[model samples]
Target: MTLLLSVALFGIHSLMFYLLKINTDSYSYSLLELYGFFTPIAVFIIIVLIFVHRKNKDAVGYAFMALTCIQMAANYFMLHPMLQQNLRPQKINFFILFALFLAMETIITARILNNKQ
Candidate 1:
């Protein structure tokens, strides 16, 4: 179910961005690349969360919590170059994609974290 949801969300997210790009071409930050890069990482996180939830239910949340800091650093690294630029649209695109995927990842992790009940 997690994999399926990720794939579906990936498609929808990609398609939504493409449609938005069709209307205006100011966005050149390679937001799709950002999404492409993180999608797999997100899946891996969910998988590890699941395994931890199974092997050590008590550690699943800790693992994810620890992972969140790494994620923040990684996200900053990826956006650092873009941050140097003064393009508002590119920044907007980056945040939109970032928030969408982050929310999805959070929901998946929340499901795993709550499964202990």
Candidate 2:
């Protein structure tokens, strides 16, 4: 369920970026393009996690949580330069979306950890 929700959120975020014309610069465009690459890989990983989780919950759960953390870190690294340039509304929108994803990932991580105990 969490994997599905995460995928949905990513899809929504990507669609919002396209519909809003937020990728005005090369850097931002690159970020969006990176997401274009990442979303499918993430979906694949999450699907595999779902299957692995059914067989061996602990290891795969931890691995999935770690993958989410790595993804969040990558997001920060990609957005950091863009955030430094200016405070445009579109940039703010990106920040808000990033925060939303961060919150969701944190909550999912917490739930995974809680379930382990």
Candidate 3:
């Protein structure tokens, strides 16, 4: 499901970028590259969350919160190159991409966390 959604998002993002004519600036990763980079992380994070929930129900919430922060930090790492280059366009694009995945991840994990076994 995560992979499917990520592919869907990648499609939409690609369409939007094409429509808007957004170009990848110097030292900035392209949108396709960004999606590829984050997709596996998102997929793995969900897997970890599932395992955490199954292994210790009580710890799932804490794990979710901690992992979410880690995601934010990961986003920062992904954007650092653009930050160093002072590219507003790429930074802004990254922000949008991050927010989309963040929301998707939060919703997916939140559902898993809230499920009472």
| Candidate number of the best lDDT | 3
lDDT of 1 by residue, 30-105 (tens): 5457657777777777788888888988898799878777877888988888788788767786777667667877
Cα lDDT for residue 62, model 1? Answer: 92
Per-residue lDDT for 115 in model 1? 75
Q: Which scores better on TM-score, 2 or 3?
A: 3
Steric clash pairs (candidate 3): none
- A best-first ranking of the candidates according to their TM-score comes to 3, 1, 2
Return the TM-score for each candidate structure.
0.77, 0.51, 0.89
Off by over 4 Å in 1: 1-28
> What are the per-model numbers of colliding residue pairs?
0, 0, 0
TM-score of 2: 0.51
The alpha-carbon deviation from the true structure for residue 25 of candidate 2, after best TM-score superposition, in angstroms, is: 5.5
lDDT string for model 2 (1-117, tens) is 545665676678778769977755544544456546455545555566656666777777677767777776877786677787765765665666566555654565456446653
Q: How would you encode candidate 3's per-residue C-alpha lDDT over 1-117 as one tens digit per residue?
A: 989998998899789878987665563687678989888888888899899988998887788789888888888887777778867777777888788877888898889977988
State which candidate has the highest TM-score. Answer: 3
Worst 10 residues of 1 by lDDT: 22-31
Q: Assess each prediction's global lDDT (C-alpha) against the native.
A: 0.74, 0.62, 0.82
* Clashing residue pairs found in predicted model 1: none
Using lDDT as the yardstick, the better of models 1 and 3 is 3
**What is candidate 2's local distance difference test score?**
0.62
